[model samples]
Target: MISRILCTAFVLCACISTTILCINFKEQQWYYVISTVFSNVSNNDYIDIDLKTAHISRNVYGISGFIDVKRDIPDDAITIEIQMSRSVSGSNNYVVLPFKYKENILYCWLNNMYRDILMPSFGNCSNALQLGNREFKGPLVKKKFEFNKCLVNVDTLPKYLIPAIYKIEFKSNGLAKIYVQLIVRVYNKVF
Candidate 1:
């Protein structure tokens, strides 16, 4: 009877160990890959977008670009909307994701929020703007704001992203109008 109890305990411990190993393996096997990045500007009288570099190399994506603000935009004047969608298999249509974020650029910048969800995959607007010799705090001045060699950090992404093609759209309205789109693929990494 003692031997049977020992055998059962050993089997239980083995099963628990196997389960832990599998969980760790699964977590380490998934990663993100950026497929494409596109930016568009409408009503150029107020602003112009110039994407100097937007490309994916070695499964990593980077964007180097600038936006020329023609006029000074006051705080609370610029509102941004972000929408995400997933591409349907064998179809040109995309299914909209349940996630949508809309807020004022000034508020987001001041609060230092939504770093993981912002464009060019930046941690914050102020920091991203600093790379281009600009600032996003207070009034947006009439000047060229830039973000150079901005990369998407996978570690900042959500823990679980479905393995599929996703398209993220960013729209800015109010003082100026701008649009940006990003297409990416989430896949499993082969060992």
Candidate 2:
């Protein structure tokens, strides 16, 4: 009799607790910014993009890569995009273009996530840059640009996800800071 009573009490408590918790459940979406800095990069320095383990998140759903160079650098100064390939067919290929001149800020993000709102690929719109496929680009700030719908899988090749590393040939002596912001959504359960 006592065991039966105890079991009944336990079940009741569990049900009550679950009901209380579910009453406070809530959901939210937010993002955290992680920056990778290349301090005091000299003139014409080819700073290979290096990402420490902490700088990268396996759970990252989306990312935006850009560079912040000192104001002294000429607006006309070109920031080249070198895609170090990993696939067997295309190993390493890059294009030298003035993304900075075309737009003050440049960033890339995959399609099927938030393509309509992000910056478009560097070259032809028809041939959008692929992250896991080795295509990359340079310097930027916050601005309105068409984002490409990246069909490529960035996980296949780690280098593909990063926006820069090919080289930043500085016209003047100044430091450049490379940033890759990982966009993640979080939910707050209010049960």
Candidate 3:
């Protein structure tokens, strides 16, 4: 009985060790890096953006800048759309990803959907605007709104994403039209 118990214990230990090793190996297999960010403001009559501080640092990216709102933007006058695409290797072509979000009213979307669900997954929406004395929940009053080193939490991304270059586009319309694009690369880690 003593010998049988010792054998069972040894088997269990070996199985647990193997499982831990496999899990570590799997976790170390993939990583992502931000490459670039680009912004375009179509109509500067209502708003102006300065995204000079948005750049990649040590494989991570952060956005820090100010947006001057020239006029009071009504809650119903704003709309937002986000779309993502994956670039085909060795070509300039890009295939649209299945992820896309659209909201008709910016105030309602930011206060309800983004505040509760998306904010935690991406970054702190409140902190992003706090430097400018602004709050994430807003009708976007006329002011110089600033962002202080806001980084996207990429760890929440799905692990099944294959090695490729991905592009994300954020567009807002209403008082002013603004478009922003972010590019990132996902690749397998080298052992």
Worst 10 residues of 1 by lDDT: 125-134
- True lDDT of residue 125, candidate 2: 27
Cα lDDT tens digits for candidate 1, 45-154: 77888763455466566667777878877878877888999874825578998878765575464344343344436544323443232334657677876766676555
- Scored by TM-score, the top model is 1
TM-score of each: 0.72, 0.22, 0.69
Model 2 over residues 59-89: C-alpha lDDT tens digits? 3322222222323333234332222211122
lDDT (Cα, tens digit) per residue for candidate 3, span 106-173? 77667654555446643453233221323455567888766665665544555456789988887898
Off by over 4 Å in 1: 2-29, 52-56, 88-90, 103-105, 109-127, 130-137
User: What ranking emerges by lDDT with the best candidate at the front?
Assistant: 3, 1, 2
TM-score of 3: 0.69
Runs off by more than 4 Å, candidate 2 = 22-110, 115-191
RMSD of each: 4.6, 16.3, 5.2
